[model samples]
Each structure stands twice: as structure tokens, then as C-alpha cells.
Target chain A: MSGSLQTLSDFLQCLIVGLRLGSVYALVALGYTMVYGIIRLINFAHGDFIMVGGYTLFFTIPAMLAVNDKLPIWLAVIVAIAVCALVGVTVELVAYRPVRKKGTNMTALITAIAMSLFLENLAQAIPAIGPNYKIMRRMFSNKAVLNFLNISLDWTTLLTILIGASVMIGLQLFVKKTKLGRAMRAVSEDKQASVLVGINVNRTIIITFAIGSGLAAVAALMYFAQYSTIMTTSGTMLGLKAFVAAVLGGIGIIPGAMLGGLVIGLVESFTTGYISSSLADAFVFLILIIVLIIKPAGILGKNVGEKV
Target chain B: MMNKNTKLKGYLVNTVALAVLLMAFLILNANFKTPFYSVVFIPSLWQISYLIILAASLNLVLGFLGQLSLGHCGFMAIGAYTAALLSLYFERAGIFTDKKAPVFIVSILVSLLAGGLLAAIVGIIVGIPALRLKGDYLAIITLGFGMIICNVINNLPFAGMEGLSKGSAAASLYKTGLGFGNTLKTKYAWVAIVITILCLAAMFMFIRSRFGRAIESIRDDEIAASASGINVSLYKVGTFVYSAFFAGIAGGLFACCNSSLSTASFAFTNGSILNSTFIVVMVVVGGMGSLTGSMLSAVLMFLLNYVIKNVIKASGMPLFVQNLFKYPMLVYAIVLIIVIMFKPKGILGTREFSLVNTIEYIKGKLGKKAVKEGGSK
Candidate 1:
């Protein structure tokens, strides 16, 4: 009886770990799906926005902590969000916008890759952040607040769940209810029709990038909160994983990104916990290839016929 | 207007020129060690042979089949590792004990053939699902495939695979069964040149056949090609597999030439030109769907890389900027971006380089009345 109870607890602990990772992926995957919906771009650099947001937090949090001991985290989170949004807008304007205007499919993909490489290598070139690991000191206290059925829920874990849930719920509500959100949907569904309907396609697209990048900032906070290490190359791997989640949930669908993120997170965590940690990535990709083979459009994506 | 006679002559001229270039490299290799001129451009000739094969094979998939695959290096790595392991097994078995010419040649032939065959099989499996998807999905899946190969290799246990690894991630090819160290170094160029010409000839002949025409039609428009009774899926997979086969051969050649073999040499983890992105850039710069363009761009880009590296070294640039130059991927990334943005069709733009056309170009350049053969770019 004790052995069974211990196994159950271990499983629940694994669940909590999966959920913690799922939330960060969910946030980044949301941004990916949104931008992809609007622009039909993979935006290989979307993951780097998390790093940008992370650097912002690293610089701003310490400064804000000097001002007020307790209120710094929230302030720093807001600043990071704003900075990421601004950076997203700037990247869109400088790199993606010109390519989009030209309307070459190959160029768009190449430019996205170039932008991604540029950010990664540029970050490495900087003297302060030259390819070394920068530590994000622990943010939340690890006090176990609840013990239900012999499963302990710590303060950090609970807050991580709350943060992911609240932010996801808030985003869902905003995208579903607001006028601007409707404009975003309109642009994504039909760019030319949206233009005829008096929707500013470029502005809506830019705003979508901003919102997506801002969400990436939130994901960064969640990442630093849990993993606690940031490096120049970390963003590319994170971005690739998030991109997989976005595709697995159906590329353009909003709720699908969240569901996909959780599935990937669970898959990853279970693989790491049950199988060898080294083989987790291979398993994730294998699963993705299998899913794609079975359902090419993804779980939530609709099968749209091509017009001849 | 020049007739088919002139065109055939032009092709003959091109083939002979390629032979001459190979002979020159062989002569240079036999006499001197690396850094023949001490100008940091020694591998420019040897590197071109494999890169030409890589670029041309990639063109078959990306240029002809109209698939944007970024995981091409994955197939190459499969070939390299497979060839290396096979050679290691042969060495252990003592078939290559005396290092005799005939036995060593047989071993290399078996290993290279096995490597290429293995890569092709994997390509067919990867291509079936990947080719079905359109656009970005295919690209991302290939990207995932490359990473998975890298990770799996990194995790491959040392229990059965002797020589374990040099670095934490790189597998060793120190005592390969192909030949001795000095001899392999000298004759490797000859092996590369022969294999390269054979692969290029096979690819060129295939590209000019009925099958090649059908594949090109698929790239032009999927719906129209299907309407015209082209088995789109069949042709797509066939071309992709064929491309991967040659890519595997290229990888086998790479394993033969290089002293060290690492996962970094075959993936985007390091900012080297060995990855899929670099190959894609070369194909695009050469002109997708143009075999001659692929060849020309491969040689030109290798030279360009040599030039860039030498220029960076010779210049008294800033410390950080010089450090940045250590990664050649940055410049390739920029080059890809600029090429894609400005000249989407690339330098050749679906045209083959003809020797006759070059003669005409030089004649026109010297202010002579040049006989026009075809259209000029």
C-alpha cells in the first residue's frame, strides 16, 4: 500500500513538472501560432524574443529590486514585456516588412532564418553576453503550501501554474472578445478582404507580432523562474521546441497552441523522468513526425482544400 | 544560330575542362603538403569537389522538386558515419591488413556504396511524409530530422562503436580501412575527382532525360503537372531519394578527405558551411533547377569563402569583429538573405553554363562580331 502511494505521488510530481514546463512553452507557442496565422511565416526568431525579454529582466529586475524589495518582480515583468514588444515591432519593420512587401516566399523564409542567426550571433558578439551562461537567481520561494493525497505543492510550483493559467485565460478572453482581436482574426483569415473591410492589415499584423512577442516575455519570466539559466543559444532550441508545439496544435489555431504545448511538455517530462534524459529530444521529434504523418494538418487544424 | 553539333561540342569542352582542373589538383597534391601557397586557400580545390556534389544534389530537391528542405546535412551525416563505421569494421576484420591497392580499393567501394545506399533508404522514409506536406511544414520537419540525427549520434553508446569518440560528441576516423594516412591524403583527391565526375555525369544525364523533364514540370506547377499525367508524388520522392543518394556519396567523400569527423561538421550547431542552410544558399545562388549553375556556384562560393577568410585574417580588424569572422556562417547568412531578397532566381536563373556561350561572351567582350547562340543573362 505504501509503495503504491509513493508511486502515485511520484507520478503527480512528474505531472507538476510537466505543467511547469508546459506553461512556458504554451506562452511562446501562442506567439508563434499568432504570428504564423497573420503572416504565414515560421518566424524562426520568435524564440529569441524570450532571450531579449530575459536580458531585459536581468537588467531591470536588479535595478527595480534596489528601489523596492517586494514590488520588483512585477515591475520588471512589465518592463520586459514592453521591451520585447518594441523589439518585435522593430524586427518586423526592419527585416520582415520589406520582405513581405516584396512578397517572395523563399525570401521570407531566408530572411527569418537570417534574422534568427543575426540575433544569436550578435548576442554572442557582445562582450557582456558572449556565449556564456548568465544565471537568473531564484525568483520565488520554495515553500510547500499544500499536501493533498500525499502530494506536496510548493509555492513556486503553485504560482507557476497560476501565472500560466491566468495569462492564458486572459489572452483567450482578449482574442475572443476585443475589437482589435477581431481585426487580427480578420487579417489572418483574409488579408485582402480585411483591407477592403477597412482593417489596417499591416497595423494589425504588427500588433499581433507585438502581442506575440510580449507573451514571449511572459514565457521568459516563467523560464527564468524555473530553469534559471539564460544563454545566447538557449533561445534557438526553445524557439524550435515552441515552433513544434505550435505546429502540433495546428499552426494558425490559438487554443491549439496551448493544448500542443501541454502535450509536448508532458511528452518531454515523461520521457525525461521514465526514459533516459539524453533521449528525450529524439523522442519528442519522433512523436512529432508520427503525429504529422497521421494528421498532416495537426490535431486542431482544419483540412482546407486547395483552390485550383 | 548554333546547331546541336555546337551544343554537343560545348558539352565536350566543359567535360574536358573539368578533367583538366582535376589533373591540376592531383599534381598540386602529389608534390606539396597543405598550405601550398601559404595564403590560406589550400582546400579550395578539394572542398569544391564535394561541395559541387552537395550543391547539385540539393538543387535536384529544392530547385527541381520545389521542396525547401533545410535538413539536407542530416542525410550527409548518415552517409559519413555509416561509411566510417563500415571502414572501421573492415579494418578490424583485417581485409585491409597489407594496405594493398586492390583490397583497399574494394573496401572503399563497399563502404562508400553502403553509405550512399543507407542514406537513400533513410531519405525515402523521411521524404514520404515530408514531401506530402507543403511549404514551411516540410522545412521545419527536415530541421527536426537533422537535430534528431545529431542528438542520436551524440547519444550513441560507446560499447559497440569502438574508438568511442574524440570530443564528447565527435566520432573518430583515425585508423580507417581505406588506406594509410599519407597515401590516403595524396590519393584522396583522385578518389574525390573520379566520384565527383561520375556523380555529376549521372545527375546531368538524369536531368536531361524524360524523367527530369517531368520533375521540372512538377516544380513549375503542381496542379498542371498532375493534370498532364505526371505521377507527382512518385517523381517527387524519386528525385528526393536520388538527391539524397548523391548527398550520401558526397558525405562518404567528406569522410575520406577529412582527418577528423564530428557531428558539428554535419549540423547547424556550429556556424560552419557544412550545414543544410549553406548548401541551400549555394543552390539558390547557383540557380535552382540548373545543374551547371549548381556546379559554378559551388566552386565560386568555395573560392568566395576562401577569399573572405583570407581578407579577414589579413585585415587588422577589431578583436571582437575578428572573433566574429571565426564563424563563417554569419557571412553566409547575410549572403543568403541578400540573394533571396534581391535576386530570387539567383545568378544563373535556371540556365546552364555553356562553353560556347562563354566563347561568345569573351568574343563580345573583345569587341569582335560575336555569333549569337542563345539568350544572354
Candidate 2:
């Protein structure tokens, strides 16, 4: 492995690749941050939502292509997102709500893990989507949309970044300007206060789940774009990484998650690109631990010292 | 509530009862070479004993300390590799004794101790900063450490040691398969049961100790405990270390139970959090903070899962049920979810079960029944 880059083009290429992958992680991390911030539950099943999205694409692409010679890629994307949102909300209502009301945080945590297990293993149990790697049919071509010197950015990477940016911006504005967004902010700030003020806490939480799952859906599409194959275990790996992103960027802050994801993706890409490939995961964790020890609140997150 | 004298007596009586029950259980396995014994019952017992150790150890951290740790299997992996490697060295060098059984006896103890001690040291390193984080942050940190342990195990270089295979992961193991290899049938089962008994007893004793009481206090009210002069971090980290040590011992017993040592054995979620998550399931099902519950649930869940799997394979069943059982892990998920949803306090709910209490309750009931009959007459 070369410690030094041969050219600026190579550096730009690495940067582009990192951004493309980082965007997907950022989107997922945002979902993680939102639900965790509001409810204080680590939704382990959040990653399975991505897997659900992948399966949706698996079903929809051919169906749409059958109707016409061309695939309605945008329509498929929308459907996948909707399906994932519905599944996410349903899981919350069925599994989490009951536990939240009556059980301890540990019980809730266990429930989350079980839900994750349920989703992945359920996929494996289904004959069509059993524990085998299913190759996704390529709907888009990988061609260089922009080239400068030796630096070239492909269409898939460009699309992933654009879609990620648009979703994030839209989410940011919605949270800042919308009535529901203020209610979400107020609820996270103080649930008791929010309820006293006539805000429907449960509804806000359900909406958050829907939005988080929706982000996972978009991330799934990007994940498929990057790698043409999907497997049952893919969610676990992606979930773990996005979780690292969530923890790295401050646990509750949106910008922190975004920053954390990009940093993780860059660390991973650069480590694989310049250092030993086997060491990439170790390096990411090492960086996370170091940053956390130095700034436990995470980047872009406000620090609150533990007095007791 | 009870004096030390009574507690010691209780511990002793419990040990005797356990010894009798476990021995009879083993006798059944030794006598029967049937598929049910070999495939379902025997393996379930072997797994139950060590899993009891794992669940009890995790309870020390999660239940008593009130902290969630997602990476406990990392400690188990550390123990498994260390103990396996050490015993292998002893076996290869011909140091302990010429006889195979004697060599096994001597090396296993030393190796288990070494494995546990090393795991404790690593636990301290992982516990310090992680303990400070608290709640969910602590969980993620522990999870990070666990992943790092996995990465280290999968990539650790053990090639330079003489008589050991070169490479990462399972390379440095004693051998690819059974140690002492059926020379002593059910030998590892004996090792597992003995260790489980010893570990569970130790946990029982520790939980009653003054430090253990302090640890429980911290769990209930950290600030209040700290105000009362409890060393919160020390106790928290101590409990964490204690848990890690036993988890390592469980790993050693785990290595003994298996034919070979491999990275996959201590895998994280890639195996569906195979060893890690299920161990947590046992703790939860047993009821948090209850050692007895941990042991019972480990035995019960393993039996249920194994039985259902074997039945699916051996008997005719509806395709739907068989399909559900096709992935055993799916059943585990469903089991965990349902258990939490319905019995959130778990089967025991921080309460310990004892034969003495049960006998007394029965005696009182019979006496009451007799009195009621006389009064009616």
C-alpha cells in the first residue's frame, strides 16, 4: 500500500468515492440520531429497513420493466421508501410502543435487538429472499459524467451524492420550519412539557420512525448502486457502520451525524486506498474512540458535562 | 436479611443438590448413545453449563451494575484463544505429565486461570472510559471494543510460537478438533459442569458481599450512592472486570466443549450475534440481576431451541412450522421479542429461587391444610 498519492487526480478520485459512500452513511446516521435523540432507543432494526428497501427494489424493478421496456426508477424509489416507512412505523407500533410503556430501557434495548433479528431472519426464511446473495439488476449505467485530467466522477456516485444532499436539506428545512418539526424539537427537549402543551408525543415519534425508515430506504438504493449484490447480512454491516457514524457525530445532533458519517467513510476509503485493507475497520474504531475521549459530545454536538 | 452462617449453609445445601442432579443428568448421557442423547440432550447440557457461566457473568455487569454491554463475547474470545493456546503449548511440550488425562487436568486449570486473568486486564482497559459514558453511550463504546477484539482475534499473529500453526484466527489453537479426543468421554462435560457450579457459586457469594451490595446501590441510585461514599467508577469498573473474567472462563469451557477453536465460534452479529445476543437473551429471560434465572433460562432456551430444531429435522410437521424452524435464529428472535413483550420482568424478576424456600412453603401449606380440615370438623 502506498502512503503517498501519485497525483492530485488520484486524491480527487478518492475524495469522490469517499463522498459517495459517506452520503449513504450520513443519511442512515441521520435516522439513527433522530430516533435515538427523541426516544433514547437504539433502533437496531433501522439497518434492516435498508435491507427491506433492497428487497423492494428487487421486486419492483422487474415488475415495472415488465409493464414497459424501461424501468420507472423514480417510481420504484418512491415505492421502496413508502414500503420501508410503513414497515418501520409498524415495527414501532407493534414491538417498541408496548415495551416503552411498561419496561425498562434494557427491555426496550432487548426488544430492539430482537426486532433486528426478526427482520433479518424473516428475510432468510422467505424462500425468494433466503440467505443467498441476490445480484441486483443494474438499472443505471456507470459512466463518467465529469472528467478533469485523470480525475473522473461516475454517474452513480454523482446521483448518490445528489439524492443524499437533497434529502438532508429537505429534512433540515422540515425540522426547522414545519409545525411537526417544532413539535419534534419540543418533545425531545422535554416529553412531559410537550405533552402538557398538547403535543401528541406518540404521533411525533411515529412520524420520526417513518422519516428514519424513509432515509434508510434511500440509503439502500445508494448501497445497491455501489455494490450490485445484496445479502441478508448486509444490513448488519451497514447498520454497525452507520451506528458508528451516529455515535461519532454526537448521538442526537443531525449535523454531527452527517459529519461523523463522512469522516467514517473517508477514513474507511483512505485506509483501504492507502493503508492495509484489513486495518480499515480498526482504524475507524480507533479514530472514534480517540475523538470521543477528547470530545465525548461528538463533533457539532454541544457538550454537557456529567456532574455526578 | 440472613446471617453469614445461614448463607453459607444455603450455599452448601445448594451445591449438594446441584451435584446430585448434574451427576444423574450426565449418567443419562453416558449410558445412552442414541441420537437424541448425542444430538439434542448431550449437546444441550454441554452448552447449558457454559452458557450459564456466560449469562451469569453478563448479569454481573448488566443487571448488578445497571449498564448494558454489547461486546461481552470479546472477553470470551480472549479467554478461549488464550486458554486453548496455553494448554496446547503444555500438551506440545510434554511438560505436565506423560499421561493424557493428567496433562489435561493440570493444563486446563492453569490455562483457564491465565485466560481469565488476561481477560480481566483487558476488561479494566475497556471498562475505564466506557464506564464513564453511561447508558447508551457506554453500550456503543463497549460494542466498539468488542468489534476491535474481533478484529484483533481475526488478525492476531501467532505464527512465531513453536508447534503452533502460522496465521490468524484459529491458527494457534491446540488442534483442529477434540482435545484428548474422546480418550475421556464426557470429560469436557465434567469440566463444564464443574466450572458452571463454581462460577455461579462465586457470583452468589460476590453478590452478597459488601462490595456487591455497594454495586447494587450504585445501580439503583448513582448519585446517592456516591454521596454515601461509594466509589462509583471503581465498583462499576470492578463489576465489569469481574464479569469479563468469568466470561473468559466460560470461553475456556466453551473451547473444551468444542472439537476445535475458530474465529467463527466467538463471532459478533455475523453469526446473527450468535453467541453474544443469545447470551443476552438468556440473561433477559432469566430476569435481570437474578443468577438463578440466568442459569435456568440458559438451560431452558437451549433445550427449547434444540428440541424444536431436532423435531423439525426428525419428524413430519406442517411445512409452515418447519419453514419457521428452518432458520433456528428466527425462532430465537421471536422468542426474545415475545418474552420481552409479555414478561418484561423476566421469569425471575431480580428474585432468587431456592429449594429451602420452596420446601418451607410446601410444609407450611400442608400444615395449613391440616389445620383448616380440623377447624371444619
Candidate of highest DockQ: 2
Cα lDDT for residue B137, model 1?
Answer: 76
| Lowest summed lDDT window (length 10), candidate 2 chain A | A1-10
Error of 2 at B16 (Å): 2.7
Q: Per-residue alpha-carbon lDDT of model 1 for A9-116, expressed as tens digits?
A: 879978988898888888899999999999999888898899998888888888888888778374688999999999899989988998888736776776787787
lDDT tens digits by residue: candidate 2, A102-142: 99888898898889888998988888998889999775668
Scored by lDDT, model 2 comes in at 0.82
- Candidate 2 - CAPRI tier? medium
Name the regions of candidate 1 deviating beyond 4 angstroms.
A147-152, B1-7, B32-34, B37-44, B98-102, B158-183, B296-311, B314-332, B363-377
Q: Residue B272 deviation, candidate 1, in Å?
A: 2.4
lDDT of 1 by residue, B11-74 (tens): 7887889879878877776676654432233344457788999999999989888889888888
Among all windows of ten consecutive residues in candidate 2 chain B, which has the lowest summed lDDT? B159-168
DockQ, all models: 0.55, 0.65
Backbone clashes in model 1, listed as residue pairs: none
Interface RMSD of the candidates, in order: 2.3, 1.6
